[model samples]
Target chain A: MTDTLTCANLSKSYGGVVAVRDVGFTIAPGEAYGLLGPNGAGKTTTISMLVGLLKPDTGTVVVGGADLSADPMAAKAKIGYVPQEIALYPDLTGRENLRFFCRLFGLPRKAVRARVEEVLDLVGLADRADAKLDTYSGGMKRRINIGAALLHRPELLILDEPTVGVDPQSRKSILDGLERLVADGMALLYTSHYMEEVERVCDRIAIVDHGSIVAEGTRHELVALVGGADRIELTLDGDVDTALAKLRGLGGVTEAVRTAAGSVRLIAEGGRYLLPSVISTVDGIAAVTAVEVVEPDLEATFLHLTGNTLRD
Target chain B: MRPHPVLALVAANLRRHSRDRVGLFFIVVMPFVSIIFVGMALGGGAAAARLPVGVVAQESDPVAAAVLAELRAHPDLEIKTVGGEEELRAGVRGGALAAGVVIPPGSTRFELVMTQSSGSGMAARSAVDASVGRVAGVIEATRAATSAGASPAHAAELVRRAQAASADVEVVGSDTASATPRGFAYTAPANLLLFTFINSMAVAAALVESRRIGMLPRAFTAPVRRGAVLFGEALSRFLVAAAQAVLIMVVSSLLFGVSWGEPFGVAAVVGVFALVATGAAILMGSLVRSSAQPSAIGPPLGIVLGMLGGCLWPAEAAGPTLDTIGHLFPHAWGMDALLTLSRPGTGLGDVLLEVAVLGLMAAVLLSLSLVLFSRRTRTL
Candidate 1:
């Protein structure tokens, strides 16, 4: 099947300053593609171009089959964009806000009521849909903001930092809901500075910085680019020195040391898979009380690629 | 069965406004209060003091002399004698005199002239008519006696003896010429234009708020074109202005006895002026950076323009230079159109120039505002 979204050589500038430059990517149906970057790293600018809110100075965006620059209405109709801010009428009830977007998107009158209700339920705000948005918590308003985008069931959902200021529980709910949508074959272009969120939600990740994508791959492939090793920490009830020696002797283990806390910290390739072997290898020498496998993740990859932390 | 985007946008804005109690009170209720207060304070109250009137008598007959004497004696009228009927008419039209009266040679017939635009003019007409009725009673009694075969001198003598023998009686005649409504009628139209334009400017804050809340950017992301968004905003302001104008027209006519002259003419002026106000509102909304900026600046700006446009006072009374300057604002033209329609025989055709000028103002303001708005949204 054709990709749900395809954009190439997307570049935008303002007054001799480039906001986004030559960013390219595609999301096939059912894939969760993430544009991972720090703030001011051109994620929003790139999303602006993709959603047709901003015209790229030099690029082409095609949504489904329609070119964005040439056939903006058709291209835009296929995109459901959730902006970073809670962009809704505060005086309107959550349900009212949803219904308004339904009309704005020109949903069929006969289906709008049902579609709004479905979206309200999908965003987990069904019980409080009658409350005014100003009365809602930030997370609830964010959910409604998301719900508004879903009323028309666009083929591709473009979310820019969907959970920037959300409470932990609401953030979990949002991520879970998004995962379900991706599983149901809706393509998602998620952008955020939050490393863990991208790791948990994205099927393919692109690390963006300085108006360009420096790296793009699956989670394992990205981590492999930085040649990062997982650190495995083990606490022992007996024979700590001997257990450290055995861990060093293991094939995947690159280095082993005993922490000041008396636990053995081992750096290894495929540390999570190496956990079973380490536990067994240490068994004959000592009693293993606890084990934690700190796997290599996109945070390290981001830092290695951009030489800056995600928060920067 | 999808609703049109522009209608949906308008409905949403109006709905939001309806839910705002403070905004509703100001937009819907305040104009009536202003009309009543300003109307009473200016000319509609029964306790209002005496008004000046001009009189021109073309004959030296007893009837004309008696009517002139009675008018001069009336407590409510401060009468001034002018050279001719044309001078009297000019005094009333120029607002130097409240009303004018002309008595022809050898005839008991009297003509009353009043500018329809002034509430004081109406009051002066009523006072002059009451004073003329007293002399009309004596004339009738004298004619009755003469027709009964009494000589002219004896007829006069008999009427004088009858008046001295019994309590005096007064007869009133109803031969009054019509003009535009005065007093509360004048106040209603003036306040309608003033409040509608002011309210339209104030609601520019809503547009600024929409931008602040990211509604404009979100709207741009939709399948709808940018023109739809601009048109929706313009239409919303137009509906509000038109609705306010209609409400004032209806309430003033029903409760205050305001006669809006020439329905089609009144409608034409109100409609075009609403467009002018809409254009101004959109332009203000586009130019202001913050919601508070419009609210803070709109009323004062509206009042200053209203003062210049003759809504607060007659521009003609403000002298030639100010009158010319007043026409620079659309308010003056709207007021002029409504005032012109107040004349008894004036029709829509008479005020076409005023309406056309207002329509052109609306076009230019709307075009400039839409271009700025489109650029602003595009950059968002």
Candidate 2:
């Protein structure tokens, strides 16, 4: 099957400074591929090049088998791009905004209204479709922005930081909606600095830093690359040295370090299987007040590869 | 098939503007309101001031009586037939009459007595001359006919027949020597050019807003050509300015008794000026980076240009040097065309120069705006 999007050695520079360089990736049909990066990590620039907003200095971008450089209109027609900014008419109603984009994309006149309704319903904005966008909440506006991109049902949807500045409830709703789209076989290229959000929605991820992709793989593959490690934190009422020493001796435990405030942090493989052993080891030496497990995630992968947090 | 991209842009602009209530009020309502205020202020003085003139005939001659009758027929003139030249001169000197005409007994010779200190006094003198001149021409025609071997009574009959054979003539408000356009006639066109151009600059704000909201760049991602977006913006401004001009034209005429001289001439002038305004709006849109800048700067810039172009008052009121400078702007040419159209006997052909100037302004400004706007679009 043809990849929905392919960026081979895509590089762009403004003046002497390279904004994005040798950025290469492919997204398959029905795959949710996350582009993980921090601010100014060239994720937006790469997305801009992918969306045909900026011409890359080198390499190629192919959208659904159409080359963006040679046939931009055809390529653009195959991909739906939702910008990081809310790109919509504030004065127009939600319905009006959808109808405008539908017509602009050259949808059939008779099909536009039905499609507008469908997208509005999909975004859970059918009831407020007639309301002006300025009256919408920030989350609602973002939903409409995404809905506009979906009107043509382009094979690929590239959303740049879609959940930025959204309330937690709204963020959950957006992530859930996106997951539904992916389940329906729509390919997604979700770019974000929020690793947790990406971890929740994306099936695979490519970590980008300083104008280059540092690492890329499935969630499992990437976690394994980062030593397939899980972190365990144990809060105790007494000293954690006995527990820390015991954790160090346990099989699959790489290291045990005592942190501030009578707590012990253990880096281990197969954290779920090691949980019982951890509980038994700490039973006598300290009263385990609290325990938490952090599985290997994109954040860990990013930090493991780049020696910095995704937020940094 | 889908509509042309530029037309779609224009339609979108129109739809968006229709929802902008405050913008609609300033563009469509304010110009006529300004005309009404001007009319109210000027109506009292101009409507009440009639030129009083004395007419004295020393003998009971048919020709002299005819002259007095003609002067009495003039709408702007109030005639007092005094008994003697002395009384007529005294009325003129005392300001009781603006001017007096003395017919020398039974002769065709007539003397006009008035100081040409003001335009109205000169207008009175001209009116009296025209009235008496008609009578003198008839007498001269009679004398010529008599010399050509016709009887005196028969000569007089020949002159009357000739007078009856002349074509019909229309007398307009500006036909008199005092060719001042009063009240709404002057204010309506001035404010129409001023406010329509001023309000149409709001198109710049709309353009900047589109850029701010990221709508403009989003449009470029579509299949439409870039020219479509630029033309769409220009068309929106032209339509708005044209609509405002038409509204002011129709409303001022219907509400006030302001006469806009020729329909075709008026339309040509307004259409050309609207194009010029559209060009200005597009240029402003291209130059400004922030949305609020256009809204803040457009009106003041338009007003300054309008003032320089004589939209506030007559270009004539500005000294000759300033009037020369005023013509450098499109507003001056537009105002000049409107002023010419408001005059008696003016036609489309009479204001060709003004039309040509406005057209040239539109062409130059629109070309420059296109260049700048396209460049700006590319960078975005």
Candidate 3:
């Protein structure tokens, strides 16, 4: 199957300042790719070029097999973009805003309503869709902003910091919605400054700093490049002391520490691969309610590559 | 078939603007208020609507009394009786009267006191001259008869006969058959152009706000062509300005009895002026980076242009310099067209030069504005 998106050696400069340089990446169908960077790290500039908002100074962007520079309209039509800021009419209701966008996109009359309703439901904002955007909370507006991009059912969704100012609960809801989209076989190119969000949601991640892509790979592959191992957190509903003792002796676990009540943190070489053995080992000792396989801290991985923290 | 994107954008813009109460006030209310105020101030028509002129007589001679009575009875003269020449001069200077006339004891020639700065002063002086001329004719007839050795009673009878004969001659106004607009005719179209042009320019605030909030950039992201959005914005502004002009025309015609001659000519002028207004508005929208700048600057600049363009008064009334400057503006050309039509027998053919000039103005301004606005959008 063709990749959902491809960008090659893209670069952009404003006067003397180079905002992005030779930035390139690709996303496969049904995969989630994250463009990770700190502020002023060329994330937005790269996404702008990808979506045809800004023409790159050098190189090409192809969306869904259509070369952007050659056929921009067709490429643009196949991609959905949710910019960082709320690009919405504040005086208009959520439904009105959706209707306007759908109409502007030139959707057929028969399909507009159905598409709008489906996207509204996808964003979990069907209940308050009649309220004006100005009356909405920041999180609600962000959700509607995402809903607007989904109206045309584009093949690849490009989101630039979709959860910038959202509260935690709303952030989780947004992430959950996005994950469902990926599961439904839609490709996503997500850019964000939040390391945890990119680590949690992305299948492949690219770390960008100082106008260039410093590193690009899957979470485990990136961790391996920085010579870091994964951390596994196992939560027991019962008999936490016994599980902690057994967790320490697990083969893949180099070290195990009891971090909290009923929980043990294990540093393992292949945490996700070791989950089955870890689960079985803890079975007789205690009932393991949940297991979280965390790849080596992306923040540490980023800092290792750039000598600066992601937040910086 | 689907509506064009430009039409959709225009509809949305019009809807949004209509919902703005402050904008509606400027569009609907302010122009009408200015029309009524300026129309009433101009006394609204012909000789019967002329301004008040004060008269003071040092002598209660019958001829003087007759002159005063004749002045009071004249259609163009609204007479106010003062005590003497001093009071007459004071009334003219203090703006208590348009002009004042003093009849000295045994003198037929009167002292006419008037302010050169006042717009109504010329009308008052003319009325005074007509009234004093009647008194002079009567005195000449009586003195000629008495010097010819006629009886006093006979001289009085001859003077009465001469006065009767003098009233028989018809007094036609110098401007009666000419194309100059008078009274409310002058105020209506002038204020209409003033309000619509300036109001259209001031509405650029909405565009500035849209650009600032990223709505303009967002619009460009749609599948529609880029020029369509810019055209949509210009069309919306043109429609608003045209609507304002029409509203003022209808209200002034129906309520204030103001007349706009030659329907096709008037419509042509309005259409072209609205086009100019739209161009100016878009140009303003492109030039300003913030809403505050246009909101603060547009209306005042419009007022200065309106004043120079002869909205408050005729361009001829202002001196040669301002009149030349006034003709340079679209408002002055628009006023020229409407005023030409105000003549009794004028037609579309009479105002063609003004219409053609305005059309050229619209073309040039619209092109310049479109170019500047397109450049700004391209950089974004």
Best by DockQ, which number?
A: 1
The local distance difference test score of each candidate is 0.84, 0.81, 0.81
Sliding window of 10 residues with minimal summed lDDT for model 2 chain B: B39-48
Candidate structures ordered by DockQ, highest first: 1, 2, 3
The share of true interface contacts that also appear in candidate 3 amounts to: 0.20
Chain A of candidate 1 compared with the true chain A, TM-score: 0.79
RMSD of 1: 11.6
Which residue pairs collide, candidate 2?
none
The per-residue C-alpha lDDT of model 2 at residue A108 equals 80
What DockQ does candidate 1 score? 0.46
Output the lDDT of residue B77, model 2: 76
Q: Model 2 fnat?
A: 0.37
**Candidate 1 residue-wise lDDT, B206-320, digit = tens:** 8888877788789888899888988898899999899989999988888886777899999999999999999889899889999888778988988888888877765544667
User: How many backbone collisions does model 2 have?
Assistant: 0
- Cα lDDT tens digits for candidate 2, B1-380: 65466766777788888998988888777776777776444321223255788888744787677888888887767888788888888877766677888877667677888854433455576677777777778878888999999998899899888888764554455533334454566678878888888887876788878876778777777766667767777888888889888888788778776678889998888898899888888888888988778778878988898888877655555668988888888888888788788877788998999999899998999999889887776533
Q: Would you list the clashing residue pairs of candidate 3? A: none
Ten contiguous residues with the weakest lDDT in model 1 chain B: B40-49
Scoring each candidate complex against the real one, what DockQ results? 0.46, 0.29, 0.21
Residue B84, model 2: lDDT of 86
For candidate 3 chain B, the 10 contiguous residues with the lowest summed lDDT are B173-182
